[model samples]
Target: MHCSVPYPADHPFPIENLPYGVFSTAQDPEPRPGVAIGDCILDLAALTRTPLFAESPVPAPVFAEVRRAGSRESVSNLDAFVALERSSWRAFRRFLHGILSREEPLGDDVLVPRTSPETQMHMPITIGDYTDFYASYEHAFNCGSLIRGADKAMQPNWRHLPVAYHGRASSVVVSGTDFHRPSGQILASPGDSQPIFSPCKRLDYELEMGFVSGCFCLSIGAQARLTWHHMQIYGGKATQLGQRLSPQQAQEHIFGVVLLNDWSARDIQTWEYVPLGPFLSKNFCTTISPWIVSMDALEPFGVGQYAHEPALLPYLEHDGGVNYDVDLTVEIKADDDEYHVVSRSSMKHMYYTLGQMLAHHSTTGCSMRPGDLLGTGTLSAPRPDGLGSLLEKSKLGREPFGLGSRKDMTFLRDGDSVRLTGSARGKGYTIGFGHCEGTLLPALPLLD
Candidate 1:
């Protein structure tokens, strides 16, 4: 994976990095799938026509369906699209790498007309359901101490399993989509005599990563049955062998990682999440950057799992192997102000890996799908500088930390914008999920 020629040194897409996505030009009638290489998009559909791709391991029908499905459309549902069983994915990557080599022909036919960066990248997949998991120990402890008193912070089972709750997927939007502030009922005080209904006051963003399942698991038995049947009938073991994934296999199931910002309304959450859990405070709008960075691209950065003392159930148990080495950081910017890095953390802080979460989630035989998203709850480090949310950084709005412009933030205020960026560094290149950002608009004017 060495290259002699450079691609301007700063382009998001270099010959060494070919992230895939669907895009379209104003002149083009519809969106088509392509790979980013240098300043151009390697039109996959066009490339499929070349003799080079004739023997590609990727099923021909998959490319045809992509062209037929049109560009800028959801590619998540297309069955064969993400089914690059490990071997196929590796082969395709090598094929593309060879073609994009500096010595390869850099002629007009090989490149497609470039599309504007401003062009929309539709939701990569139609998310069926979203589950946010509290896997980061620092984030859990920090937020727990604020609401549950310092001594009685995390729940007894917090360290044992991947704690999560189902979230509304319909409200999840692709990046660049503006979200309207949500109106909800809240208690004026913890022991208030009455509840007040109003738009949320403390809206905030959560920085997290997500993983997608590859083959749909009807049931643990179903997967087992399929593997056995394939081996018996085809006289060949299933390509994706082995039950229960290692940290590496867990990465393979990841279609791609995205910068997810789970918008929150602390005022509403505080009042509602007593006996039940977050309801109105959370379900408003969540945004994710459009591109899905394949897990294969992030393999170079896999790291050791976070330490844990709690014992696990038989179903949830593994080698305690979970986590990634991706470095994550958040930036906040007020109106017309310079952005400042507020926190720095790594996915390695997570108590449970995505594999453990999936195994635990489906232990009850619940079905899992390709586009379903599992949010690795806010990744926070142990120190204050690594804090992930405003609630923790500002001591629940009681303390004010000064930003460079004399601007102090207790929590997000109207017109404040937040951005999250992440990357997995490699030998000669970097894999990045651009940015997930959103600005808080003023609440709708009160009605007379």
Candidate 2:
């Protein structure tokens, strides 16, 4: 897609990758939906107010609704856009693509554009709930071996279903927000008679990606199923009581993918996680990238899913399994004023695809709400350096990850900054999630 606006040839925000986000400027402090086109943000709200978008080949349902209601202002979040149907999603993108492309160009001067650096990004969606799934086979196997020993490595049910845990949505922060190290109860030894409350001794980051939704609500009791059939995926929760989502089309409901860093307190988690799963250890903080690269922009990067043993259930089985080929990386910038590439991996290492995770998530009919995040727990590969977390790279803090010959680290220090990035490569451009980053702050002083 050729565009009049100038952007770096290799920039992530190309005309073909119009990822959406919530942004504000010093002049306009109200957060509104915006699309990243090249290096500038195409103000969707402003565009909708003009007669140009009103001339789209297909009806623009999202803005049309707002226009009919006589509201010229933009909605504060993706709530309105998320409610849009598949056709509307396509129409909106097609309209923007058409206008931005040379085929049916519009004047760039009237769109109320903002250079990226001048604008501030906010939480794209008011996340209703969050769930982190252990979907990477290599990561799961490595961590399981380190924790449960080589003989008992993976759980019996791992191969059959996508395992997950409910995450704390309240702690889900947007990228650029640094957080203090969390403190929680810990056991001094494996068989300790008593527990101690203290700051985390082992702090780490999980390099993963998450998907948000625009579909209806899903609850555990009712259970939600991702009906993936005919190249369609619906986010609407299971409202028919026991009605299950089909497996024909499971990709439709997903808004897009974002880089996610699920910070972990290994000491606290190792002590508390058991039959009940992670609790206080996980509720403190989770970081996500600002922009959401919609599924539409990623369709070109899709390929057949990786092979796995053990047959999947009928609900989980589908033809032409789809998965994105995205390259991922993590880096650490410490107090020494240097950034070190700690690990580099790819999303293709994941044992189960995002669709499988969503399908398993709602298999019980759990209703998923718009902005609900589903994390692909710690993406890792078979190589030691390809591991996602310090736990695996350091072999549980026993070894140090190398940063040249002079520097090494087993776990993060107070001033350490970790950034996660990922992108789907295209012919001459890239579809990317800019950055999901967080700095480790000193934990608050402990009580006497």
Candidate 3:
């Protein structure tokens, strides 16, 4: 699995972890897709210049479509590429692995200068739809206990199905993008007669993992077959395609993983969310690591999906491991120049696996587009420090925690920065999503 690329022992990007992202250099401001390899970016646009891509067994119609339509030079947006079948994805990766090997058989001409101060990163995918799932056992339990009495913490249907809500895809941003604190109606005091419209009083971040959807071949007609890839590009309802996706079929549709920070305003959520799920409190911003580590790359670190206490139904059961043992960490940094690890947890603590989530989502035959994202909800562990959100850490602000600065607070303050990182260790490699980070800016003043 080794390649000639000079990856340091501790580097997040390795030959084995060729995560993809969209980037641009100062000289060429137009964004394009590139692959992370150690300190440098393997420019996909530049790769097309070489004979490798043309020589690979890329699906004909897909490649032909790209060539026929003079698109952007860089594979900058991976939406179209991700829609290809698994075989094509593997073929593309193999071609990359060989060229990146020590031999430099293709020569170093295609390499882009290393990512640095001059380079700019963009959102890797044009997310069509976003769904955030409350799939973690510890996170859901802790949040429930804090919000409701322990006696009635777990919702009756929580274990029976993967609880989720459709998220705002328009506001999803890449890492390092700062956003102003969201303003919303909040109850100034508990049991207040009326609510006040003001800035969020309890701004928080949810540490979670995100997965991107890819291509899936569907058995449509009795004698004919169609890949979900074609269905999406052509446009059709998945349910009309005639069959529900099995767990195994659902897993094949996963493209990759990214670190996700689902920003929340606790006060606003508490006031408004009763029957309906998250709305304004979450729509202001949702940040994600720019690079997406392909499912193929994460395969080596995969572990079996956790067993369901109340055995899952037949549709949710699958043949292989769906979870990866990725270590996730959240840190907060302030102007005082101090960095502190606020929480540490593993993705394996999730009660429902991504495959299960996908299967459940498609049970009704809902179509999943190439760039749709599914978020594994706040991945907290049973340990005290592993709590994922400030609501849990501060227990609804009754207690506050220190943030390296002299100030001990429950929620985020303006200028406070939050960063999340995730990685899974393999034989000699660390497969990781570089960082999902954001800084909170002062709330905007209201118009007169």
Candidate 4:
């Protein structure tokens, strides 16, 4: 499908892939919802003001409500849009695909040049809660083997469930934001009796993908059988607080996917992550791409789930293509200002699928909210070149990889910048998460 809006054939956003985000132009300073269509953002706010949605099979009010709820503040967040019924989501995506594929060119009023200096992208969703999962078998095995030896690489419970930990939603930021290198307690040497408080000596980046959760439909017994649209309008009939979700039910809860960079301070993590999991090592900053590629758009690129040794529990078992074959790459920029591709991986390497991760999360009746995030941990591959993080590529800093001019490179430097990008290729099109990137700043001095 060709888009009337002119762009390269390989452009990440096309008529087939209308990823949503919040953007503001200099002329229009208020952030508003938009979808990237061939290098330009199709202004949803402007489209809503027009009569575009009048002919849609889905009620115009449904689309209007999402826009109104999301566009209320200075920085428009897609939380309200995420909370909409799944049917509305499908209708909206189809409507967008229909218009952009038309032969007639769209007007400037409804299109903003994405690369223009004035077009500013912001965090698409106001995340309520975040969970980071260790779901990659290769990544888990690599890290475990490096730390505890190959004999104990596979944790006893690793094959059973998708292991995860609650993450800090407050520190979740949009792409292009800079963050300081974290300072925390770490062992100065292997034999050190006590840990020393200092700036992180081993700073790293994790290449991962995250899925945003959609609406929370209250299960009102038989009334739950009501049409999703009517149930959305009536706000449902029950006040059930905690309810378990099967793998099939959990599939509908996912809104979209984005590239995620879970920055890590390895030294801090090594020192602190003992009885409990990662704390200060991870909570500092986690970056995500602005655009969210809808689950509908990703359906074309679906692939079979990775092989699981032990049979999955009934709740986590699902047939068909649960994982996506999105190609992921990590790059680092040094003083020269040119990005060097460091690692190449794929989401297909993930042992646990996003559906399984979400299903396991809510299996205990934990209430999940709209705009909640679930990260797929480090997506390392079996090959050495496909390692996701520097810790793995560098073998815990013992073997430093070579970059231009700087041969000894293991961890991130003060001025080094890391960028992560992902895309799934299709017949003459691409579905991509724009860019998840951030620069490292110098750490602050210790307390006096």
Candidate 5:
């Protein structure tokens, strides 16, 4: 189908990939739900006011909750809309495709120029909890080999389940938000016995993919049967506590995917990560792309998942091609330095699929909520150039990678900016997660 909106020739936000986001223009300063179409953003709030949206299958009540009473301003985030059932989500997508591709074009007021300086994108959803999962075999293996010998690389239980740590959701920021380098306790040398409190010298960015959870519902009966009507009526109340999700049931909980950068403080992590996994070293700041690519838009790019040895338990077992074949890249741009591509990888490198991760997450009967984020940790490819983080690319700072010829990087330096991007190729178009970017500011001054 052809799009009425005019976007660039190789635009990432084409008719086929109308990723959702929260944006505002100078004319309308309040943030509201929007979908990217070429260079313009279709304002859902405005569309609701028009006749075009009158016949849409998307429930009008959901859109009503977003705007303030008697005003066009959006007073809320996308938490409620994200909690809608899968059927509703599909119906809305189909409705959008029909109207956007029809011969009758939408008015200019219904669309905002996405490239305008007046336009700004914000965090689309109000995240409740964030979980970072070490689901990449290559990343885990590389880090393990660096610390331990190659023979003792992977932990025995690594292949058994999807290992994860609860991260600080409050610290999660949208793309383009710069942050100060975090300070923490670290050893001065490799053999140092005492630790010193200092600014992090080894700041790094982890190239990862994060899936946002939607549709909270309690599992009923021994088989965990879910009632679709409950979601439609109540609009997804929180999932009941002590409710477990099987692998087959986990797929429905995912709303969409976004590019995520789990910034790391390697030195701080080295000293404090012994007993507990990651603390302040990681919680400082996490960046994600503003636009979320829905599962419907990504279905065409499905690929076979990586083979897991020593077969997984029945609860965590899932069949079919759940993994996506999206190509990923990490780039670095420093002040007065040229932009350089640091590393290249793919989502296919993940050893565990997102469904497996979610199933394993709630295997112990943990409850889930809408806007819960689950990150697929550092999707590092097996090849050297395809490493996902500087920790792997630089070989634990023992080797420095060059960015152009004038500058070299062991880890991110102050004023250094990082950008992570991903794209799933289709017949004649591309599905992309708009850039997940962050610049490192100098650490705060030490107190006397």
Candidate 6:
């Protein structure tokens, strides 16, 4: 866990923390996947040239093919690549550590130029399924009070389990992608009048964390024969043949973690979410940071599970179950150029751990794949300023919070930008998910 040489003090990546992602040099023909360390991108293609990679158990042919295929496009499909066994990935990281740790001549050939500021990063995977879960206790309680009375804040099941809904994965985009204002039907009052179609009046962002699924094998004939397979198989040649049969060995299918922003329309959600759940209000758009911080990299940050009140279901139970101790924060910038820390919370606040969520997701025997995504919905804090969304912070637009220049605010307006950041603190190195950011653009004019 210790690195021999120090990366630049402020560098996002260090040898101790090699977070992987897709990147391309300014002069390169296309983007290729690489690992970040000390301000430089460790070119996987170039790193493959060394003898270190030749000795590893990773199928060299498959590795070479994935690297080549990924290099051709602006973003590499890391989902298929990282699912390889821990041993293979460990060997690769160890090889990289030895080479990138020093300024040795052997390392020079593998090093891509220190040009991150000039280069662009793309989404590391092609997300196939997206599910957003209400896991944060503070967020649920606070928002619950807004709709329901203070005494009746949280639902009975809120303290017991993780509540989630399926979201549209097609709408998920990488950071830096612009989101258009959604036009939806809104009702002024419930059961009072007909709804009107108009541009979203209250556009907001939900600060969240997301973990990608590893891989699961599903049997063709049997319903209960589904099993979890180690991720390493995903990068092998057999994957092309789809060896993921139900009777085969199944393992935890966890790819990594990424910062996520679930853009929401409060006005639309309030009217739509009742007997059914979020529809157009949340489906319009979602964004995620590019880097995928592997679960192996976050081993040091794992902590005990969130406190539970009622007896849990057997499906959600596990031995030595726990959640990650990741520190999360959200920042907001107003039109006047002032930045404010809106909320600070930890992943430990989640009522359900990723393991429980995944287990619950599959309890009904639903098939999961390499690129599926599960969002930890709105991680909020207990204090007033620690709220995650504008709806909770502004008390559902009933009370206003001061932002220096502006005397009042309900939700995001044009020119308002929000950013989400998360990191796991280690002895000397910090593993981080680079910012998931977006700016609110003006809603398009409506036709009469």
TM-score for candidate 1, please give it: 0.85
Give stretches of model 4 more than 4 Å off.
54-56, 67-75, 218-240, 446-448
Off by over 4 Å in 5: 59-75, 218-236, 446-448
Candidate 1 lDDT tens digits, 7-64? 5554545655566666556555465666666556677666766766665555554544
For candidate 4, report its TM-score. 0.94
Q: Each prediction's Cα lDDT score? A: 0.68, 0.77, 0.81, 0.84, 0.84, 0.72
Predicted candidate 4 versus true structure: per-residue lDDT over 1-448, tens digit per residue = 8678988888898788889898888998888888898779988878766666555665564666655744463235576677676887888777787777788888988888999999999988777689999999999999999999999999999999999988898999999999999999999998886999899999999999999988756453332322433234333322134566677777877899999999999999998888899999999999999999999999988888977888887778876637899999999999688899999999988788888888889877666666779999999989978999999999999998787777899899999999999989999888888989999999987669
Instruction: Give the per-residue lDDT of model 3 (tens digit) for 81-178.
Output: 77666777777777678777746434455566666888789998778789999999888888888878787789999988899988999999999999
By the TM-score metric, which is better: model 3 or model 5?
5
- Better model by TM-score: candidate 1 vs candidate 5: 5
lDDT (tens digit, per residue) of candidate 6 on 127-221: 76799999998899888888887899998877666799899988898877777788898876657568888788888888899888754433343
Clashing pairs in 5: none
User: 1 or 6: which has the higher lDDT?
Assistant: 6
Candidate 3 minimal-lDDT segment of 10 residues: 230-239
The C-alpha local distance difference test score for the whole of candidate 2 amounts to: 0.77
Tens digits of per-residue lDDT for model 5, 7-105: 665678998988999887788788788888888888887877777766555666544543331144433457667876676677778778988998888
lDDT of 2 by residue, 279-361 (tens): 88778999999999988889998877767688877778756667778999999987567777889998777777777777677
Which portions of model 6 show Cα errors greater than 4 Å?
1-6, 9-11, 50-75, 102-109, 113-117, 189-192, 217-251, 445-448
Residue 242 accuracy (lDDT) in model 4: 59
**lDDT at 264 for candidate 2?**
93
